[model samples]
Target chain A: MQTEEEFRDFILNGHLYYIPHVTIDCAIFGYHAQQLKLLLIKHRNIDNWSLPGGYIKRAEKLLDAANRNIKDRTGIDNLFLQQFKTFGDPDRIQFDKFDKKKWLEDTGLPSWEGNWLINQTISVGFYAITDFSKTRLQTDFITEACAWFDINNLPPLEYDHDEMVQEAMHTMRLHLYHYPIGLNMLPEKFTLSEIHALYETLLGKKLDVSNFPKKLLALRLLKKLDEKRSIGAHRSPHLYSFDKEMYALALKEGLVLS
Target chain B: MQTEEEFRDFILNGHLYYIPHVTIDCAIFGYHAQQLKLLLIKHRNIDNWSLPGGYIKRAEKLLDAANRNIKDRTGIDNLFLQQFKTFGDPDRIQFDKFDKKKWLEDTGLPSWEGNWLINQTISVGFYAITDFSKTRLQTDFITEACAWFDINNLPPLEYDHDEMVQEAMHTMRLHLYHYPIGLNMLPEKFTLSEIHALYETLLGKKLDVSNFPKKLLALRLLKKLDEKRSIGAHRSPHLYSFDKEMYALALKEGLVLS
Candidate 1:
């Protein structure tokens, strides 16, 4: 929302336009220079940091809602986004510490009872992958701050977001074994070791140098280029690149990279 | 609901007890004797068939809701279930073809506008695997008939259920490659061919029989018995049972049978 009036209207009658008790929260993992990061934001009314998310518009597709949430919070668009899981435990969101009195005061409401925003919600979790160095963070009226944090050293997240991150990481890692990623995260033409390091960083584990690349090669998802790139004396390695057609096919039909 | 009054209360005041705009739908696939089937239900208010599903209660976990939906529709409980995906397209459910006038006439309602039951809901899709020959069918108040249909020759499903089944099958098949299944679908002691045909049936394709069993055996999810089972005068094949501990661990940690 751009103005206080708009925000007030959204708070009072948002269910008219947005689906109440249903939301889309995203775990945006950013990678660049062998470093992994996550995008988090602080809400204007909340004391804790949370994942980037928003209510899905009544007419919007969930994927579109996810893309809009990513853009609204991160100033980034068109990152590869995937639905990881949906979280709907009754205790997933803890509201005991929320400043209900202050919220009612700010919204100019008489009581918190039966408020549209106070209803129990189940959030559909989606994970997005992007290169952090390629984008800038943007915040809206409801956002206090938006930035990327190192995935390894994240601050204590609010509500069920910590669990959401763990679930997202697990699904994303599992997806790496079947689907072809790194189309946007890596250079068009790269070496096997570059892609190897990409996998190690994304998977958060070291892979055997010789065996892992061969597995990827056996899937025929990559192409061997005759061109070579030299890093040192007598140490030129053959440049390789992802076969775009095969990569797309793998994304649909899936492959077993193990 | 067992009574019409209870069903009416559910229709009118269900939002108070159930989360609005969110639901759980299940694609229960049954496998037995080299045959694959999908459990589908014909709702009393609709002519077309749908997957077994219902609203998630405000105080209930999603998995519990899934289990309840399966039991309410299938008369079976505790089958292995997994959440595959959530469907949230605004057009997923088509009210255009619904018999709204008959619905209101039966409900004794003046109009259907602003009704809680008419809200656009996003369904969490889950797929369950079971042995079809072991369980009997049951029907709830809203359900007209429930039965297992051959997966390959299913009738035209209602709303977006055809898409739901397709997505469920895709995810389930992918899971079979990475996880161990067949705890309840197969006998405790079975030959390699039995499991091989089970996979072939669920996958809807003929696999290379010799090589596929080797891949499954390599996962160490199976235990070969010292004795063999004789089916013919001279042919005796070794029987194998699942390594329950490893199978359970694989369900949690996942395994790459591929």
Candidate 2:
């Protein structure tokens, strides 16, 4: 845990050496229990939530900054991540509504630090998919709470983050249609129906059950296991896992699903 | 036309109020003579060419900057432009080789403007499709020459611009797969073979000639016009034009072409 003074110095002096007027915000989407969720963090005293984000170091690659932010927030590494868009609207920071000076003063920080916080910032949006079961959320000094919220039922977000999340979801849905994206969110082994549920959750619509399986099987990207998923008083669906080599080939060739 | 001294003031003082350390580069892809070409400009006394680009104004939207740049270079307005990627590699500006000081000295610019030129800049890449026949290429004070080069054979470019052009081409190809993108580049009326040739030029591969027409017609986005295109010693082909309303619907539902 960092003291207030230490935190203030880190934000003011330490971050001054970084590339100014630019930031990276990540919409880390996770799937678990057939629900799509987004990881969000709230500042110590702020009521509104925001995406896990950080500034780009002066020498750091943009993608590396996104990867570092995800690892810092979730303690998870080697996740599936991609830069979806860059938001550079002049009013993106919404400084009119966000009183950076007052917030810095209330937090007992020097007035000079407010300059760094109030500047116009252009943010690159990155979307990451991780297995929800594997992530252990952690909060840093600036963040008081970090948790996952169901994508369909998100809390009020800060500074155009709601729009960012919607864009991320839209990009992911488009990606899912052409690529095998559920592999990162699904377990090592899962039933076909479970994968179908994941797609439905991301697409925000139910797919035809009979046609879905046939379309997926045609790609030949899934390997059937001897095991089966047994649910109480229901038919047991055969377990399956990604055929890694074939899946890679299918992704390259593109498995288009209507 | 701006004198060297006036241009120095514009770079050093006039642009100081705008956003620093960021720029927008547009790969204006135009189709003419059945070939896809990219618009490029060369600075006065500079041997190498680059995409028609400009720095972002502090109050300007990123998209607006791209639009402004396109209008300034081509004298074309309301273009079909979309930002495909943001190139933020720390060494993107390549100050080591670019030598802003030397360039300014050679161009008779003040050394102070070199300071602004040497600073790190992250560029947003936008790809625009336009009717080549409709454009009037205009060269500004900074640009000595402006013209289009076929995508297959581009001249040596400056500051990672070759990579930017490649990325733009890749993005446009992927976009062409899902959307009716040739509307802006093709003529008001074109033969089926001409449209097919346009796609082949963009995709860098020949698609099935027989099935291509059937697939495109099934979407009901193209209407057979009463006109026909004639070539000497060849059979005349019936001309077709896009059904605007149906084309928009197809774009929304996605006209997926393999």
Quote the chain B TM-score of every prediction: 0.94, 0.88
Model 1 ranges with Cα > 4 A deviation: A2-5, A45-47, A99-112, B99-101, B104-111
- Tens digits of per-residue lDDT for model 2 on B122-155? 8889998876777888876677888988887899
**Candidate 2 CAPRI-style tier:** medium
State in Å the error of residue A144, model 2. 1.8
The CA lDDT at B47 in model 1 is 68
Q: Give the number of the best model, judged by DockQ.
A: 1
Residue-level lDDT tens digits of model 1 in B1-258: 545566778777887899888999999998989889999999776668889898999899999999987887778887778889999999888777765545755645444667787778899999989988999999866677998899989999988999999999988988887788788888889999999999888888889979988887788888999989989999999999999999999999887776
Docking model 1 quality class: medium
Evaluated against the true structure, the overall lDDT of model 1 is: 0.86
Q: Write the per-residue lDDT of candidate 2 for residues A6-71, one digit (tens) a residue.
A: 667756675456777888999998887787788999986678999988778788888888888778
- Which candidate number would show the highest TM-score if scored against the true structure? 1
Say what the interface RMSD of candidate 2 is.
1.9
Q: Which predicted model would earn the best lDDT?
A: 1
